[model samples]
Target: MKFIGRTVVLLLIVNILLVYMHYKQAGDVIAKDSGTPTYQQEIEVMNRSDALYIRHHFSGLSQGRHEIIWPEASADRSCYALDAISCGRLDASLTAFVDGDNEKQSISYKIPKENSESQAMLYHEPFVTLQGATVTSTLFHITDETRSGGMWVNGLEQVGSKQMDLIDYTFFQGSGGVQDLYWQQNSLPLVYEGEKLAVYGPAGHTEQFEAVDAALKTIGADHSAIVIDQTSIAVQSQRFIVSENADIDKASTLFLTSAMAARYSIPQQERLLVEVVASILGDKAIGAEQSRQAYDKLIVALTPEELALLKEVVNSKAGQEMNATILDDLIKEVTGFKTSYFKTAIQKDTADHLFLFEDTREVRVDGTSYADIGIVLKDGKSLYPAKSILSHLGYTVTANEQSLYIEKEGRKFRFPRKEPFYVYNERKFDVRTSPFEVLSDEVYFEESWFRRLFLLTIDKTAETIDIVNLSTVLEEVIE
Candidate 1:
């Protein structure tokens, strides 16, 4: 499903993830298979010579231009590269294509009814989304992405507003309990910045987030309980990411996805939610009571709240009394089923656990410590969640997100954004290139290097470092 991990503090602790297992779906299920791409197909797909045409079958051509799209079906089996011929769904101006490009191509299709014998899955009546991979203008220019298995395409710069779809799926071990639940699909139908993941999983269909939200509401404290809190992002990178930051960006992606769930989406947008999250799901499998206990423990630790407060919230606010109606809607887009899904090492007393949100949109400065938070109410200010901030700092804070960075009085520490930042045993070394967060006028790091730097520089220069044990300092930082 669309995964959204964020920190949400209920009026009380009425929070927990709505994890569910899948039993047998109550309908004649549609089947699907992953398509393959060939070298020849690849050349055809990348053939930019043609105004690759694409138009949605369901919506038909808007009052705009249309064209035949490039195909990507042959690049790799079961991959996301759209076959140039099937590369449908191009973004439109709602006006005709200039230069006689408004040619007619058909892809008017939508999810089929359960009983409909006609093509019901995504592959069947596989509608084409014009401008499927076509990049557009945006503040955050997306260059490319790490697609399933391998690269989606070469020379592919990521961007916003690309035509996309969602897939709803459940991982089941025969008649047994659910093993995994995933709602794979593109979160943004189009975007201005950031890599949009193209997720088309087992259930080749988009689900109704609104319905899932409603179902979630029904499960509130009365049926179940859940409390969510704000999240602190931790970014760690192994190598310098000049063009992109993989590990770091992944954390930020989760953060943004969670934020999206916190906010509701419109009908058109809501279709992106996966099936499990779109509706009240599997109750016929697994140990509900046992699973519930595990879930409770997971959430309680996530909040790091006093046991008393945790008891109060889950017992009352989240105790099926609230219905978590808002969260239900949230799951439509930012869907997370289990409490563990939301739980992350948001921070630690070290920088090793930190993650980056953006590679270039933001910057980092040398510091001994810091905090990271969001503008909840926009008082033109926001409260820095202690955990969120300290985790970003290299301090010995309670939770990693709320961790701190401290060093010896006379020692100095240094951390950089690029790769090969440190050195190895003999040559220069490398460190997890996680960026720290700034909050409440402090830089927090969950990894050791950033923390050591912050700690050592407590009273000394924030820039220059002591030269006596350069190699030693680097070695200590490596581990």
Candidate 2:
């Protein structure tokens, strides 16, 4: 009896070991089968190769025609290279190879002459664009797509303490012109100079205005808001605030946005806007000179009323005393400024015909006809009540705090509150307008829900919301 009991215990231990070994083996097999390099890894590898190719080809390709080819798939499975060899003529005509997934594509440019001066026209071809990198063509030529020339990036002989990624160099053969194009990874263009373009990025975290320093004028405003009395009786308060860390470009952008939104009809009104912006950031190191230049150009253009308004806001003791509240004040003084958030109204069309469902049933909900059922605002956006539409289509509709749930067959869709985006079949889409509003006890959604999700078309001519039921169509075809 003791021997038999020991044998049973041994068998149980062996079975447990076998089960453990089986799972380990299965896990190893799964890992081996699913070991493809991830998409992000592919992107990184491609970017590095682009850098390499650009470096190798930057100066000039071989003088004669040659075909360059790389494999469609990288050996390490890190990046996707192209499979086909690209052939192009190099002597009389210029050919450009555009990089793409799984294939090589080429575009040709006409070279007027064989001399180096002729090659300067290569810049006319749109240089290659990368996802996180920008390359600017300055003086030289582009033979390679990846690497910028190694020296003097963005005017610095060495990159120094500042950060820079790539610099491409090209020397014009006889013109003795040296062009330097500089770019940094994941940042704005450092130094980009092309034809009809001169743009300079911020030199440091802050900038000092050369004109402000030369003029030797000191202006300070303690507060952001200023109240000006053109007279003792007519009192207006203008508030414009600028943050300490805010640069001139940002100030200009904010000023542009407010001025544009103000919708000023007259050029003088816009000039007043510029003055307000200048007064707001005039003390700052940046934008002061730019503001002054703009003011000089616009000063001659202002009418007497606009000029007086500008003087009242900028040159007066009240204007000087006025501190941070300049933005609000200038916007208010603009000709057609509106304070409301939503400017456009919902738009609707006149209903020419009555509505019916596919089954020949007149569509009605809550004593409202189909024409009255959908609300079209002046913005050309429309919405229909979810409960009414879902019920007519035989869908089970329910609502929760976060979303309105609609289910038909085995498919479910969730439309969230106050979100212009919706989820269907586990996919999210921007339906142009959020179009979802909850009024009292009912939920409403845009007409896009029916057109996009249910694949139904709203026919204004037929005056019917044509429900394209695939099953019914199939059934009719069979009959």
Candidate 3:
């Protein structure tokens, strides 16, 4: 009887063990089908997903050059927020992704919810709001769901490279819940000023090409741009002479790089082409719609008298063209604006005595500074100097029939209003009232540039401006 009882106990133990194994296999199947990971299967999908951004400390990007930046997340960002800037103050989310060996063992992580775009001085971590499975719930559900990319080796890190052209990649912008999208070209051709250009979209459709039309419109290329089919982009410009054999692939690089660098690789010749184009096209490169809006915003930033004075300046040939040239150069040289996008790199002034204006990016200095930089506003056919803008900041801006003059901070500047006008730099310039130009009555500096070019022309002492002290300038106007 004792032997029989012992045997029965052993059989029961074996039966229980077999049942456990069978259920474990069943659980695995269910997890796969339900899209829910079992306790051990979470990492399996991760390894399979090939989330390449894991290699980066900033949001790991999966493809085309990603401009992933570190973050400084905050809750009350209103104090430092600007409409042009999408990001505000914040702490670091400090997000991370680590690879592991287990296929079935699940590893968990929390993705940060905030997407900060405005550039700060340093790459700071964002604040993490959740952890574990809840972490995924709190973060955004953005995905390259198409899974349409192959791995591309970049730097020491390998990232997933999508087979997208630069146009499609840099055309759209993703902001919080809103998305801005545009079409793309398979291959694009670039036109540099002084070069003859042939414009076409897809299937060899050549319509209006070069800066012929873009230069005339006050708003610019994005709005008046001629696109061919769904693949080609033609941004009109007055700067370059186009070659009949201009290659589209090379030009595409110029447009792509000028628009977004991380998204495309441009050859040196193409870069030269962009510089030339930017030099001639100036602010007219921004779509007409955008320029109109910019003008409206800037008007709000100015005082009643300042706006009036600015209007007068924009009407002048020198004011219109010079400002357009300066504005476009600043955008391309600093913040890049292309077909439908704006990619800006915000850097703080390195000079110890310099600070950004509390309300804007314009630099300011305390004490006595010789140089006074005034942002020229576009008003009608004339370029307007905001006399009120200069006066409020303790500068005296005066304009006569033949010239625009200013004494601000400590520097003095004189701009010729009519033809045969030469900057202090003595470079030959054109004050053309071209019918096919953005500013019909404005003067364009065919051979001159603002500060960057100005500095090259004029010899000057280095001085810093305090943007901090200028905060009051905006405080009085914004309200």
Candidate 4:
């Protein structure tokens, strides 16, 4: 019996040793050695303020690059409203890897309901890197605001081969909802001035291409563009150049030569191309009819020869067939024009605040319009009535003593009266104009609120306000 007991004890000891060895091996592979330099830092922003919590881990080193995995479970969130407490949660899953050389990086992330089809991937290997480029960002503004509060880092820390910089943007907004964590890397040159694409179009059509290019540039994109003559166009093996040789698979803009566009089967690939361009431009690209109209304006300005060529290309038998059926499809694919189907142009009443919603519904608010069909307070800042606009946008609005809440689909927006800021999905942001105010039993909010919260595009000269739901647009983009 004593021998049996000793045998059992020895067996237990062996199992314990085996488990410890396995864990030790895993630890070595996962992290690095104790001497490995591991540090962390965080930047927090509350519309602008900060708080940082960091920890460093050093274990035994292994082969391959280090992987940074994000939390997959729903994170708890809390907010205060009207002396009451509210709770909500948001789910996200993201992973990133910084190559051992520290010069390359890749990220894969899923944005819960915002994106579900597949994970988005971004890989960077220093495109146009400045030799001594610093990673400057609006995050520095956050650091400046929080420094006096003693919640910011006064020093820097480098982890592994890559540096650790965590930016936390907290919207000190009103009541409970999901918060958007926006991380924009403004490190590249011309990050703010914008990027441009070299446009290659049919020969002798510089004025035609220049018109469209200038319009896009005025909207803060495709800046300093070069309109190249297609016949003698120089093809640089690069990204973002709109030319015949451009890889459509990777290129965002496609410049369809007259011949190539003619070869497209009516109502099929041509429509697809328009859709692709609209998806790429997101908010900037206009619809087919609008594009056609813009093209018409450009043609009117074209020289006799250029105009003649355009008419020839457009009035050809192939163009006739495409224009008859496929033109509508192409126009339907534009991102921001809700009035594409309307035959008549929306007339702008600049004197009064008259807004044509989708060129179908017209609303003449008592207040003046600023920044176009949006709203402007009599005080010179922009503001709008929540019920008047939200009702038109298919949103259900509820009224309370202290605030007005508007909801559409699964999204919610809260505008609190007398507050300097408003909350969307639980995150807060500062409002240039007062978010909500009660005048004669109506709730009023800033004109920019709807645009900022709902992602709706407002066009002043066109006198049109796009009410198309952005989520629906995104779903279409996904499809």
Candidate 5:
């Protein structure tokens, strides 16, 4: 037994040593060429401030030529790119490098003291060294409101004995919800002329593409001759450029200019005015008949003073410059003429001694029109259809004989039939009015209940009730 125990102990010790040796060999291989770069890029975007700081580290380099490209690098007379090796004023693009020595190198750049518009910062490395290399590219984006920031990394490739091309990094920063949906649609692959081409912006605005296509079609431009995505719109053999962040009016004007330039030529000034006007009318200006109708509506809606202001602005230098802010102001002034579509309507009927009166009002939820869903008007109160609205907002709504339950993401609500109180999560709360059954499967509650429960904005007009979910609009709804 002692001999057996001694043999077991010796085997355990030998196995442990062998395992340690194997790990050591693997660690050595990892240390030599683990595909991870020796250096990294760090970026910090200060909260509630316009300050941006970026640091780049180049630790393990061979004695050879290497380069770093920063596409978003820009400098004024006061600001410049700085490093231990060299410092220079940056132009639209910055290309910095180290040569002949293998010492560790780094660079740091800071934006100017003044506040600037939010932008995208991109980093690229394209070079070869004696030792094999791994290239990493990063993009940092900051929103204009400074409310949010994001970073993305890409182009991780092991470069062995061959140079790398400049990595393409597409960065998109957009307000959430419908805007995000549009961006997603724009990013989809578009097929044109039996060929697939990727679109990247600083260019095409997807929303304006349909209108531009319609106008082009009216003017004898081939329907398939132009292709558009959120990034850039290609007109057969030509490419038109518009900023991804361009407003509807500006994007429409630029697209119209491009389309006209490709096919039917138009005077620049006249085209600008026409495009701005069409864009202001939105999709209503898609065809000639709709354009005439939109024009008539605009004329009828504008007051004499507003008309004079519009004319003055259109003839002024700002209008000639197609200034976005000024055009936005004009749009705000004319927005009353814009049409609103509703999905459902509530009909109220009242009976008197000798007469019957009936009234109907349209309803909209979150700017979406539902033709089949409706609200109920009872005893001078607006009663909302609980299940339809909640379900439409992506809630799971279930009902029993006694109570109705609603849940979405993590929020929960329960209302006992004919009760003036509701339970949210595990907590109960009182309400001024109770929920009641209008039909076998339909239950209705006062508008205040929905407003309080869902953080909705209820805008009641004579002809319509606009129920906008504040959480969805702000893109802050719980997951």
Candidate 6:
């Protein structure tokens, strides 16, 4: 009997060992699979290569040539990379070798979508021809598609009875006389000569001003005056002067020049500028208005001279020529003036303002009242009846002895009755004000809690506490 019992115990031990080994083997398989790079990761690597190719080669490509060489193994992934890099502005056609001997294939991408349709119609062969024994010709042509009749080209000999638009004719005729003007217009010029600093570009091109300003500030050129001009708008300090033909279509030159000029600016200021630029660039996930507000606040702290320089650039002819959205971006890129925590910090500072109302205020949800209880104004902060307001807004509100639970659809929020933090998806976030109970039944929450959790807008007036549903506001906007 003792031998039988020992055998049973031995079998039980063996079974437990087998179960543990099975789980360990399964876990190892899962960890190995997870360690392997995904298709998305491979695609991202290809995309980076595609972006580098475009950045280095795009501008240097001859007119009418936009071909990119990609690895044959990932040639099929070019479309995804191009779309992402260009933000849907560009599309490509893959051309693979029939023999498949080469490791690389060529993918030809089309021009931006806005220009692609009219491109073929706009440019025709043999519009102008040049032949000479001793005469050398330099041609410059620019088309401002956003404006009506804003095209101009230099050194185009008109063919018989072709009848080109008057706006198409270049303002200056000869190469010798307008060479400096041509260079200034075609490129970004940060030229300083004899107490006069000249930056040539659109007034809306803030980057040009930023680079020139940083350079000047670094060199302590406080006595110098800046001359900024384009074709239609010109703003100059009393000491500086500008010519008539200094107009340009290129804003990209400012980016290249600014990168080089940043070396001359103060190192700490340059680092701050880089941080601001990164913040602005990364702010697409937030909103453009947030970035604009941050920029506006930053400029307010600039010195009078700096402000004047900014105003000149923003109100110039070249600035007026740019799209409003593009102008906003340029304004946000203004750097090297003052250091301030931009968007995120500014938002927090603004939100810290707590108001105390003297009069009794009624709660209005979407401009209408669904509950009889008014807002509780305590300690200079407005608190709303949480259960009543949230229930009307389609959220189920329940309370236990220690915590309150608010849920909508699949989303759940847990607020500890005594703690100054809320839990969402098991993640705790500290808040400025903690939720409290009234009369052992009603739960009151701060204005920020509603805004943060549900994106509701709270407008406080003398007589009413207006709680606006953002979706309803958007619908009204759409109408």
Error of 2 at 453 (Å): 1.2
- lDDT digits (tens) for residues 1-479 of candidate 4: 54344333322222222222222232323333333333221223232222211111112212234444333322221121212211111112222222233332222122222322212111112111112111221111122222222111111111112122443222211111111222222111111111222222222222333344344344332122221222222222112221222232122222222222333333333443332222222212223444444344333333455444433333232313443233323332331222222122212211122111122223332222223232323344445656666666678889777877888876787777667787778889786766555643556655566566766654443543334445556777899
Once superposed on the true structure, which residue ranges of model 3 sit more than 4 Å away at CA?
1-53, 57-201, 205-479
Model 1: weakest 10-residue lDDT segment is: 23-32
- lDDT digits (tens) for residues 1-479 of candidate 5: 54344333322222222222222233334444644333323222222344444343444455454445432332321222345442322222344343545345545554432434323322221111113343222222322224332322121111111112422223321110000001112332332111111223223234433443344334322112121233432111121122222133334334443443222122343343343343232322322333334344445545656655665544332213343334434534443322111000001111111110112456678877776565654456666777777777888878888888888877988888777788988999887756545542466656776787778888878887688878776785554
The TM-scores, one per candidate, come to 0.19, 0.22, 0.17, 0.21, 0.24, 0.24
Q: Candidate 5 clash total?
A: 2
Clashes of 4: 13
lDDT score, candidate 4, position 284: 27
Candidate 3 local Cα displacement, residue 477, angstroms:
49
Ranking by lDDT: 5, 6, 2, 4, 3, 1
Candidate 4, poorest ten consecutive residues by summed lDDT: 151-160
Highest-lDDT candidate: 5
Model 3: worst 10 consecutive residues (lDDT sum): 150-159
Off by more than 4 A, model 4: 1-377, 380-382, 428-433, 475-479
Task: Give the Å shift of residue 340 in candidate 1.
Answer: 22
RMSD in Å for candidate 5, one decimal? 28.0
Stretches of candidate 2 exceeding 4 Å from the true structure: 1-378, 418-420, 427-435, 439-441, 462-470
lDDT against true structure, model 4: 0.32
| Cα lDDT over the full model 1 | 0.24
In Å, residue 447's CA in model 2 sits off its true spot by: 2.4
TM-score of candidate 1 relative to the true fold: 0.19
Deviation in Å, model 3, residue 308 alpha carbon = 23
